[model samples]
Target: MTKAHFDDLKALVVDDNAHMRELLHALLNVLGIREVVEAADGEAGYAALAQYQPDFILTDLAMQPVDGIEFTRRVRLSPDTPNPFVPIIMVSGHTERNRVEAARDAGVTEMLAKPITTQSLFARIAEIVEHPRAFVRCDSYFGPDRRRRHGDSHSGPWLRFDDSAPDVVTI
Candidate 1:
């Protein structure tokens, strides 16, 4: 039997390496997902999330400036804006037990070893998107259809949309 597909959802693939991003982007498209966005690094990932609010996020752990771990922490802890608790699948070359443990502790929904295959990626995506709260706390965070709550703190990562402070929005 074939599994149910969520063809309407959008996804963000974050990685500094151009080839990796391209690979994942292609894989996602092959999965019957058409709306896939790309981010060069954690900063770009956050920006894409704020602007697009993709249904899911696939990010690489190792990157310059703000790494995946830090990015996850900031996304989880940020206040003001309601976060979607989006499922964040973090990928890395370090597959040691301790490293995997660390990634889990840092708030990643799932961890995958490098040299990602289509089977593994699709399987994990199915698992994650199937569960209502697979990666994030959806009710607490906002999605495309979800409405924004009053008093929701938007003062965290993703973007610096400070109600009090002003900053530039860059690509």
Candidate 2:
């Protein structure tokens, strides 16, 4: 695995479930991330954002008070914000097309489905934080032959294409 530039990285994990929040925190810690903050939901997540300027954020789509999409929009559009350019990742159990599309419209950098594994989480984080513009092809994570667009400079992961993998394809 290629070494990530995670030395200066700090992350905030937001979820309604305590277990989910803790799971994300633990995963990030294992990835060598030093500063990890937890929020119960979007409201708390936003509050944390105002206080701590994290390098990245991971939030759940479904929450009690506020949902993930709105939270992401607020962060991206809010002026005088601490971390306006901070990459926001949305985690959801919902695999519905509308929810995913809405998350994209709300300015989410990436989406991770439920039962998120360490590799998938880190892969999504790395893909966006490292190469902001090069879109991930949604068809598959691995390649028959991957392609890059004009002016794109970075190379992404090369996973073994398997029919069984849950299509961690980016787009």
Candidate 3:
């Protein structure tokens, strides 16, 4: 799926800041996404997601009532949503390892920093559409495959054997 073919795709922008929401709404328009829904927080975002079956979701990490992580968890784990496998891209100013890990654990498909660029935004969109990650389901987790790299099974110092794959670890 290319940008040219995304004119009909809808994107839901969830941000608590008015300015950031406006900025992201404009950027999505510039990206040829005409059908867009905006939300002030994760609670509103969840409502919007249920109201509008968007092709993808762009959300902020920190929010009141319902944060991005919680919203994503609901979207991925909730059985009442319109679609549980909808793509979600988390946008936040805090890019710390813990934040990123939390977002990933909550079922985010991608992470974008606060000051987003048109190129970077488009790249993430393209990556999600062009090279979508496979869906994974476990007893306590459900979302895109967590591992970004794969290779032959091996145990050595060069290859970190202790990883997400081949283990029953908590996300």
Candidate 4:
């Protein structure tokens, strides 16, 4: 991406750890994102959104009062918030299958594991800018389209007792 792509873009970095927040600040700065807002926890992040909306959000999954999932939920579902469709990247050291799934279900645009590299970090940001997902609102979901691709199997095809997979259309 060009400097024009990220220059002057506002971003929020929410993490309880001071070092992580600083590290994110540096990463965002390298991307030419000068306006980086920070919060110690999800509640502060929510309040910051009200005070001023950012183009994107980078939040931790675990925190006191409110976690990243709850923060994302509010942004996607709460009427008190200004925008429900902000691009959010959930960052955490936890890269387990369950944690990643939780991040996806929480409406995050992307999930980045901790100790983020320059290349991976930029790649994630670039993906967000280049490919934006359309928002979806349903009784059980209200956020970006959860499906990443037409053929992505969020849940594996149905299996019979004989272990034969069902012919299921992914899309």
Indicate the residue-level lDDT of 152 in model 1.
Answer: 45
Residue 116 local lDDT, model 3 = 88
lDDT of 2 by residue, 23-78 (tens): 88988888788799999888899999888778789999998788887787677666
Q: Which residue pairs in model 4 clash with each other? A: none
Superposed model 4: Cα runs more than 4 Å off: 1-5, 151-171
lDDT of 3: 0.88
Instruction: Indicate which candidate wins on lDDT.
Output: 3
Estimate every model's Cα lDDT from 0 to 1.
0.72, 0.74, 0.88, 0.85
| lDDT score, candidate 4 | 0.85
Model 3 clash pairs? none
**Higher lDDT: candidate 1 or 2?**
2
Off by over 4 Å in 3: 1-4, 152-171
lDDT of 1: 0.72
Q: How accurate is candidate 2 locally (lDDT)?
A: 0.74
Total clashing pairs for each candidate: 9, 1, 0, 0
TM-score of 3: 0.86
Runs off by more than 4 Å, candidate 2 = 1-5, 134-171
Better candidate number, 1 or 3, judged by lDDT: 3
Per-residue lDDT of candidate 4, residues 1-171 (tens digit): 223655868899999999999998998997678899999999999999888678889999999989999999889888787788889999888899998887788788898888888788788888888998988788877889875654434344533243344476988
List, residue by residue over 11-124, the lDDT tens digit for candidate 1: 999898999999999888887789999998888788888888788889998888878877776667567323537778888887888877666766677778888777888877
Candidate 3 residue lDDT tens string, 73-148: 9999988877788899998999999989999998999998978888888899999988889999988899998877
Task: Kindly indicate the candidate among 2 and 3 with the higher TM-score.
Answer: 3
* Better structure of 1 and 4 per TM-score: 4
